[model samples]
Target: MASKGKISIIGSGLIGRNWAMLFASVGYNISLFDIDESRIDDALVDIKQQLNSLESKNLLRGSLNAEQQFSLIDKCISMEECLRNSIYCQECVFEKLELKVQVFQQIDKYVDDKTVLASSTSCLLPSSFSANLNHKSQVIVAHPVNPAYYIPLVELVPAPWTDEKVVARTRELMTEIGQKSVTLKKEIEGFLVNRVQYSILNECYRLIAGDYVSVEDIDSVMCDGLGLRYAFMGPWETAHLNANGMKEYFEKYSKGIYDVSKTFGEIPKMEGATADHIANELTSRIPLEKLNERRKWREERLIAITQLKKTLDKH
Candidate 1:
């Protein structure tokens, strides 16, 4: 399904490199550009290693070998070259606002009017960077998480001035390239996923600081209990299924939920003993020395999970 147009990735950092692999593995021609050529140089090596890693895990598509898979990436010396025949460009540079503004300005000049310019920013909104560009209507945020080669959720956030058709096209392109995209009806801070995550994190922190639960118990509560159900069903879906349906579920639990919510207060500022406790607890489990190795393990596990999901979908 990835027989779409070329994908040009700007910035050769972790996000850009992963985007290159994701677009390439699914059969899109990938072009990468960076001011620091060494970053691109290093990225090619990392991508090759990643491809081999996926192949070792039996996760690569189209029965392609590592060498054949690596052939889809083209490292362009300049932005113009990368944008020459591209239909979409994903900018994954630093998260700074001014840097994104400058990068988008240059990319706007090179790509045609129809080409979509998507930002990989985690926080900065599209309107923050793309507002000054001539092709602002064609620009939007296509934020993907780290290790995008494995995790495919992309948030497609559009600015107020962004064209609706452009958003539709971006969503279509993401789908064709094997990405799962969720559209935001209107722009909001942090979009959907992070806001939900932060809200949970805030509650967890409050509970721990209030001495209601131990740090280890808090982590285990999700990993052992909630995470299992969350893996297959969302919160609302689980709630509905727990009862007869959505209406019945709400009818029985609305007052209980209201009372529980009333007891919950705003999260405390995490700057003192609470933060230190979390740091000590997490570090004891995952030491700073093994951080890089642990990250690789997490990526490998995500790859396996993604492969399992693909197999399940086939059935």
Candidate 2:
């Protein structure tokens, strides 16, 4: 197959590897780079294993098979080599402000005017790192959820100076790669996903701190109850469907919701005895040694869900 284009993936971590796979699935020639050269080789090995495993499960994406997709990625020793002639550069470095800014500055020096510079940050705002770059207009955040291959939502956040055309093009590219995307109108501290996540987390922490619910039970509330509906539709859609529509739903439940909201209390600090207790409870169930095993278990389910969604959409 002819290549779609070149895509540069900076950092050889899980996110960067996943991004490479996502792009390579669509036949994009991927340049994978890392500051530590050894990690690049390790990433390639891991990527091969993952692609082959996905193929065995009949979960591999796009028209290409595992071998073909794997062949599309090339390891690059230097940032300049990775960004050379690439249409998009995705930075997947660690989430420190200074580190992200430094990486962006380095990338800015190598990137051309046309390449879309995207960061894989979950919480950091785009402007915080891109403000001083010459190619700030090209910088945007394309934050993907964990296990990005299965969870297709990619948040597209643009800095204040980001070009309108850049956002449009990035959205188009995301669509081409079979990922769902939501664009932010303006920059926010945590962006959409993390903000909503932290809100839920705050309540969960508060409940545990107040001895209202056990950690395991709180998780069950999500996995067994809310997650069932959330897998198919969002909260707004759930409310809309539960009642006649959104208007009727709000009208009937508004007072009760308000009463509950009033009692939610202030955000609890995610530390101290409560944090330790939660950790101990969770570790007892899954254990630190089995975390990777559990992660694999999670990914398998995500893949199954992705396939199920595709099959359902067909009907």
Candidate 3:
């Protein structure tokens, strides 16, 4: 397959590896790098295994087979080598603000003005680390959910100085690789996903602390109920469908919703006995030693959902 372009992956961790695979599967040449060169080798092995496993299950992305996609990714011994001739650079380094700032500063020195510099940060705003960079206008955040390859949603959050063209090109690239992209008009702390996620977490913690619900029951409220609809539609769309329309839905239930909201307790600190209780309950159900096994189980389910979505969309 012809190469789309070169994509530089600045970290060899899970997110970086997944990014490399997603780009490589779509015919982009990938330069995978990490400070620890040995980790790069390990990541390549894991990527190979993952691609082959996906291929065996008939869930491999893009037209390229596992071997072909694996061949497009090469290990880089230095940051400059990885960034050289790349059209886009994705920084997946540790989430610490200081570390991210240093990495971007170093990347700014090597990348040309045209390269789209994106970070895979889940929460930290793009401006926080990219503000002091020489190429701040080229920086943006392209946060993806865990198991990015299967989840497919990429949040595109731009810094204030980020060029409009950079954001457009990044979204275009994301589309080209078969990922869904949502753009934020302005930078916000925690972006979109985490803010909504933390809101739910706050209520869950409050309920547990008040002894109003068990940890398992709270999880079931999501996985067994809300999650069923959420997998295909968001909250607003779900509400719209529940009644004749969004207007009617709010008119019918808005007062009751407002009344319940007023009665909800303040956010509970996620520590002390409540944390211990939740942790103990979860650990008993899925022991620490079996976490990796459970993660694979989760991935399998995500892949199934991904396949289902594809089939449903085609119909």
Model 1 residue 63 CA deviation (Å) reads: 5.0
Per residue, candidate 3 scores C-alpha lDDT tens digits across 21-114 of 9999889999999999999999999999999988998888989899999999999998998999899999999989899999999999999999
User: What's the residue-level lDDT of 86 in candidate 3?
Assistant: 91
Candidate 1 local lDDT, 1-315, one digit each (tens):
355568899999989988887777667788989988888999998889878877887777555577776888888888899998788899999989899999999998998888888999888888888888899999989988677777788999999889998899999987866888999987898988889888889989999888899889998999899988887778999998999999999999999999998887986798899999999999999999999999989887887787787789899
What is every candidate's alpha-carbon RMSD to the true fold?
2.0, 1.2, 1.1
Q: After aligning candidate 1 to the native by TM-score, how far in Å is the CA of 35 from where it should be?
A: 1.0
Q: How many residue pairs clash (N, CA or C atoms closer than 3 angstroms) in each of the candidate models, in the order given?
A: 0, 0, 0
Give each model's whole-structure lDDT: 0.86, 0.94, 0.94
Worst 10 residues of 2 by lDDT: 299-308
Better-scoring candidate (lDDT), 2 or 3:
2
Candidate 2 lDDT (Cα, whole model)? 0.94
What alpha-carbon RMSD in Å does predicted model 1 have with respect to the real structure?
2.0
| Candidate 1 residue spans exceeding 4 A from truth | 1-4
Higher-lDDT candidate among 1 and 2?
2
Question: Which predicted model would earn the best TM-score?
Answer: 3
Clashes of 3: 0
